[model samples]
Target: MSRRLEFSPTVRQKIIERDQGCFFCRRLYHMEHALPGDLAPKDIMHVVARSHLGLGVEQNGVLGCRYHHSLLDNGNKGLHREMDSMLQDYMRELYPGWTPDSVTYHKWL
Candidate 1:
């Protein structure tokens, strides 16, 4: 049995809709690019990494704008690493009980 690694469109759309914009803008108070007309989220980030066996459900996903998503994907190369690390703490808050074992599983399960 294989584990699903990517978020389905349905789940992705729901996340974008629920967030109503960048999750950081709405929740984390990051309004750097959130102007008066910004409403479309550019990416849905996994709280747990897909490579690390993260699932694609809403509880495990979040909406982010392009700039924020780039920061999330940037791994320890810049001072922005602190910014991304902060996001990890936020993810923990978002999914309080999430663990590798809880979020990862075979499709059959």
Candidate 2:
């Protein structure tokens, strides 16, 4: 297996500022409830995973509150089997030019 990492500090901050909160939460809940986006870099997930050559950068990052983040990663183990697929679609809409190999292994830390 190869090494993978979360977003770097600077990129993480940029992501936090850009996202402002969990876009996933907003998308899922539709702002019905108050969701805290008080997340750290650890909460940032790669839209395209590093195993597939995703870089740890804002362009490939998405913030999520703990519950939603875990659900996205784990797919709620059958609760939502297509969370990752949904996220991929959303991220692609967000980044039209971001390809898995575009910045592969170039600026990870």
Candidate 3:
């Protein structure tokens, strides 16, 4: 059996409300599997990638649909940078300890 991340119902609701829907298109995502058997809760890609430098908090994350997530991962530099900046601002306000240097924004892309 595979282990699944179990987030508190309150946390999940907060995430949904924070994004106010989709992080990219700002629309309501129907909450489905990205593919056929993925168990993830289905969220948007972090503009500044959690693995790369994202803060690993709700503010650092976006609520993108699978399509936008793909576009971000496939090196869609332009949109990626734009979203990164937006998320960064939100993070700075949410996390006072967050420094700009903590994450490198690829604005040129």
- lDDT winner: 1
* lDDT at position 45, candidate 3: 49
lDDT by residue for model 2 (1-109), tens: 2434467789888878877777666565433433445333237877776666777767778776766666556663563446666666666787896565664665543
Model 3 segments beyond 4 Å from truth?
1-12, 27-44, 92-109
lDDT of each: 0.66, 0.65, 0.53
Q: Which stretches in model 2 have alpha-carbon errors above 4 Å? A: 1-4, 29-42, 51-53, 79-81, 103-109
Lowest summed-lDDT stretch of 10 residues in model 2?
Answer: 33-42
- Best-to-worst ranking by lDDT: 1, 2, 3
**Which residue pairs show collisions in model 3?**
44-64, 77-109
As a whole number from 0 to 100, the lDDT of residue 98 in candidate 2 is 55
Clashes of each: 0, 0, 2
Candidate 3 C-alpha lDDT tens digits along 18-105? 7765565543222242453332345644545644554334544556556657656764545556555666776677778765555433
Global CA lDDT of candidate 3, please?
0.53
Scanning candidate 3 in windows of ten residues, the lowest lDDT window is 1-10
Q: Could you give me the TM-score of model 1 versus the true structure?
A: 0.62
Candidate 1: residue 94 lDDT (0-100): 67
Instruction: Give candidate 1's error at residue 49 in angstroms.
Output: 1.1
